[model samples]
Target: MSETKTTVFRDLLAATKDGDWGKGESRQGHVPAYVIRGTDFAEVRRGCIAGVPIRYLAEKTVHRRLLRADDILIETAGGSRDRPTGRTVLISQEILDAFPGDVTCASFARFLRVDPVAASPRYVYWYLQYLYARGDMWTHQVQHTGVARFQFTRFAGTEEVPLPVRAEQDAIAAVLGALDDKIAVNERIATTADSMCDLIFQSRAQQHASVPMSRLLHPILGGTPDRKNESYWGGSVPWASAKDVVNATVGVLASTEEHITETATQNSRAKTLRPGSVVLTARGTVGAVARMVMPAAINQSCYAFEPGRMPAAVLFHMVRSAAKSMLGMAHGTVFSTVNMKTFDHVEIPNLPADVLNTLNGELASLHQLIVSHLQESRQLATLRDTLLPQLMSGRLRVKDAEKIAEEAT
Candidate 1:
């Protein structure tokens, strides 16, 4: 039997300096740097670019270091106690260039430099990813600490990584990288879908005179059941919040983080959200929007629009165009809240039925394309995840993997 070798990560890697990567200035004159935290990955993947300053980094302390193309960034803390810690991201040249100087990572994020001689950078990337696969380990580790967090000392010092021969590492990394390459292709398809939708919306909005959102559609407020009632949750109905609506790129709204019982649905102000309902975030996320492709339920934080005269697709277009101005309606000293009155005041240029239908058809087609790519990406991810541990631990042969991948196509 081959014996397992133990090694300290400190011995295997060098440390990072303060300037290795710095946070960008909060603001450039009146503009602010778009700082992306761990949770911002999806949004960043969306229309939000890396350096487009929504907020300024100028007032905050600015560091001078920059992240390298090959460096690995780990999020040491985030999310709930039951969730995992130490989310790692491989920094790329594109990300580095976009988020230039004063562009900094959080203090909790640690940068690691792997020795190329012992392990390939790509190999290290896959290996570190596999270690965090369980995710439960982090929850258990931080259980006693009260707050869930990824402490650098505990993570780097204690985690036992399976180190193999350099050649073996290269082979494993290659297989995983190929899978990622396919996923990237799918992502481009998703991007194209987004671009197509953007073109239609922009063209229509520019041609029509901007009006208050109220002229577009009828508003139906969502409601939440009493949480104290056990029957209020854990049923089949998807009880959506601002977070769910904001993430959806397609017309479909199938599920949510929480669910509600039939009894709860009957008791609360919550209504059965049908397919074609235009859901808009009224609180928390504020003006974010999504269209329901399936029957679901939404919480008080979001508003559902059931089209009266306009087709569901046309209403979606109108809502998307008015999102920015509608968000501005809500004002608060601490937290922002959007009332129905505010939504009633917003408007969109009314288009002829034929024109609205044409535009709606184009958008629906684009959304369908995006959803297809998204499904493909999900499948590729699942395959990569399934093979990750096997490849890393020598259970799967690289040659066999190549054959399987070829056959998959």
Candidate 2:
């Protein structure tokens, strides 16, 4: 094994600074610039990074703070009990090319540019990911009030990291990066398939008759079993919330963070939705939709729709297309929310039986392809995650890890 040395986090960084805190007025007349938020950081995969459509700022002010290809982003604030603070991701050249516009992260995140002479940024990123997976990042977090904050200065000044030679770092990074690259390719394939399906559905929607959602589908509101009751939680039944729907990129929810007992389902309004039922977020993040791939109970924030005549695939898009209007219906001062009444009144395109069948036949294969890609990506991610700690800690050699990764891909 090559000799490895320990170094402080700050010594490896050329620069470290918090992102722009200014929430300037929207780019009404100015050029559009992308702004990364903490939520965006949370949404991305553990070792990957990408911007999300959350907020925009004036290009003039944000141009100075734009992220470079070598920069690393760390979530400084905002984390749940389950997900502790100090989540990190690496910005790559490919990401910069994808969004060519001026891009800067929001106030809740900090950016660190690694010193090329001192460390390989990709190696540092993978190490951070490994630390997070092992729950070591939590030891550097400080919880006050209710929010968990990453102790940036303390972490940077005192935290020790294993520093190998640059060549070894690059080799380790390459092994892990290969798995991520494959996952990225699969993600793009799934995204393209979904977009194609949506375009096809839009064209057919024009020829279909319109009917109120109440008439076309049966709506079942979700319920939460009392959190205080120990018996109500942790059973065989998978219980989904808005967060689960948000994470379900394929529009087919396969798993959830929390599970509920059968007794809880019977006691509450939460019903075990059958496979093919369309699940829609009716509160908080309105109109976020996913199809149930397995039997699961949903929380009060969601609505499960049993297809009357429409296929689940078509119904998923229908709700998705209506998301903007559904968001507009949200009425609350504390939190934006929509209810069953709003969905009941909303109208959706009603295709004839033959047309529905034909569309389903054409689109079903595309949907299946997407699901397959997502499943494959998940498996690859698991493998990459398993190898991360071993490679970083020198438990596995870079050449051996590379061979294993190549075979997996």
Candidate 3:
């Protein structure tokens, strides 16, 4: 590998602009727009940027400031105690197409358009991510009151980036982009499979008799482990909350953000739900559903449905189809919640034994395929992340990285 030249960030950009800060009223049947605050920066992983679907009405002026392909979106403000400011995502045509109309980030965000002759926007985006992973982004953050803000001027004017030739930059971006492309394709496959299963189940279920949920499954309400007890938290057991179920786009949840100790599960009302248990958000974010891919404990805000005679696959989609009804049952001033009575009153279609047996076999096969795709995506993501820093730093040649990336895909 040849030595890569370095240049200040300001020298590589053709333009830099902060987004519009104006607020818009929430009205019915308006144009959809996105803001930086809505971006799920926490869950964004290598090669995958989560799109914010929440839309608000914005003026035509705001639409003019919408993001373009190859532009880099940077989170300029807002930092948590654990994560500092300065996370960034590269805007691609695919991401732009996901939005119904023109998409733009909030005023708290900024866009950097690289000078085509000087640098590649994709390269700059990857380089910024490399800096973030190395904790260098924190050095460029300015503490204002309690909030951490990115020192955009100082960063743009002073922060140095290793610049490879344009061809090399393109090659690196292509190699990394391939892995991401594969991951995206796998995600689409899984989503399509889930939708197909839902359609199949719905068609068969319409002919069946409506039976009470109690007859199909036992709904076990969750309880909180003592938060103050240090021994109760942070164990190997996955502890799921309503947030986990709400954030999950897929039907199967393999893990959660928090976990609890065995002692905590034994002491509190929390119980370790079996792998096939159907978990749903019963309280705040009511009706969000997912199946437990592994044994896990749930928090008070969620409900775990233990499959009785019904297959887990059937119960999962049944709960999903009933989401609207569950939401209707939710009633609270501050937070919507569904109680035991809500579950007891709800009924699901009971398919014939022979029909159910055949459907269950088909659903099992479909779910297995989805799970396989999910696993492959995880592995591809790992490969991409591992190669990111090395490629950005010029320690690994693009050709060599391309070979590895292509093999992974």
Candidate 4:
């Protein structure tokens, strides 16, 4: 067994600093940098650094909060009803390289500089992830003004981490890092595939004058079963909500976090769509789009569209482009919602069948690649999630994890 000892969470860190929001635009004495918020933790982990707002900061603060490889960012605030605060993301050179300038955490996040002499930085990051996955971080969170805030000082001052010797830490980190690296590569592959489909759409479909997206695909509604009925939930039927599309790393949704029973589908209005149906979120998180890779039922919050006579990928990107164009139509004080009538204002290429069908084979191939990669990454993430706590708690050996990791990769 690997020898281990309990240590304060703060003791493993050489330093910790709160993040900054700085100025939203460039100004005298303000240097432009990427501000990483707690909201970005999910996207950043998936390797999509695009859309991260660049804030101009005082040069001195930028110097003080400059991020480095192996450093970790902890979310200090920004929790939701479904998700607690205290999420963490590890910084890597590849992520930093994605930005053209300096990178720093946002006001609601803080950076933890690991003490490499005490513990492997990657190992500490994996352990933090394990803790968050197991809901241990919720213990350190408190509500203030209806928002969840992580008690950083309290957590750092009191929480304990089981620490193994430096050598064992390195070994454990290596095993976990291998899994994440592969997952990251797969994510990149999936995103690139989707981008290729979009590029093809632009090149081939742009010449057409205009066609209302609604003319091609009709909106189909989804449903939710009674919450009080246990049999209605958690079955083989993949039940998708807006979050499933909003959080997808790639444009392909091969699986969902929640599933429903066939009984739920038959008893309720939740109609199941066949594979290749493109689902666009119509409420709350409106405009988020994904193509279903399997037969799935959706909730009322989403609208599913069949490919009809056109290619699935073609329809997917067309709907995505139109939804983005008509985003202003989705409006509400509480939850942003979209109506089918908004599509009349949204225009897409009116390309003829001869030109459109020519690109169908290639687009379908790319979509399939995206689906396969996403499905594979999902499985890899499952393996990592399963192994994380076992390895962190010293219940599973690094060598044993390495064997499983090797088999998965």
Question: Residue 44 error for model 2, in Å?
Answer: 5.8
What are the runs in model 3 whose C-alpha is more than 4 Å off? 21-37, 40-60, 97-100, 141-148, 227-232
Please provide, for model 4 over 1-409, each residue's C-alpha lDDT reduced to its tens digit, 9 standing for 90 to 100. 3567888988988989999999987799888989998888878887889868999889865799999999999999988887889899999998999888899999999999999888889888988899899998889999969778999999998988888888888888898888888998998998888888889888877777887877776889898998889999999999999999887667777778899998898899887889889899998778999888889999999988887777777888888888878687776768888887777767888867886687777788888888788878889999999999888877898889999999999
TM-score of each model, paired residue for residue: 0.82, 0.91, 0.87, 0.94
Q: Which ten residues in a row have the lowest lDDT in candidate 1?
A: 17-26
How many steric clashes between backbone atoms does each model show? Answer: 27, 0, 1, 0
Lowest summed lDDT window (length 10), candidate 4: 324-333
Rank by lDDT, highest first: 4, 2, 3, 1
* Top of the candidates by TM-score: 4
Q: Tens digit of lDDT per residue, candidate 3, span 375-406?
A: 89889988988999888766787888988887
**Looking at model 3, how many pairs of residues clash?**
1
| Alpha-carbon deviation at 226 in model 4, angstroms | 3.8
Give the whole-model CA lDDT for all candidates, comma-separated: 0.67, 0.81, 0.79, 0.86
lDDT of candidate 1 at residue 185, scale 0 to 100? 65
The candidate maximizing lDDT is: 4
Range of the 10 consecutive residues with the lowest summed lDDT in candidate 3: 41-50
Candidate 2 whole-model C-alpha lDDT, 0 to 1: 0.81
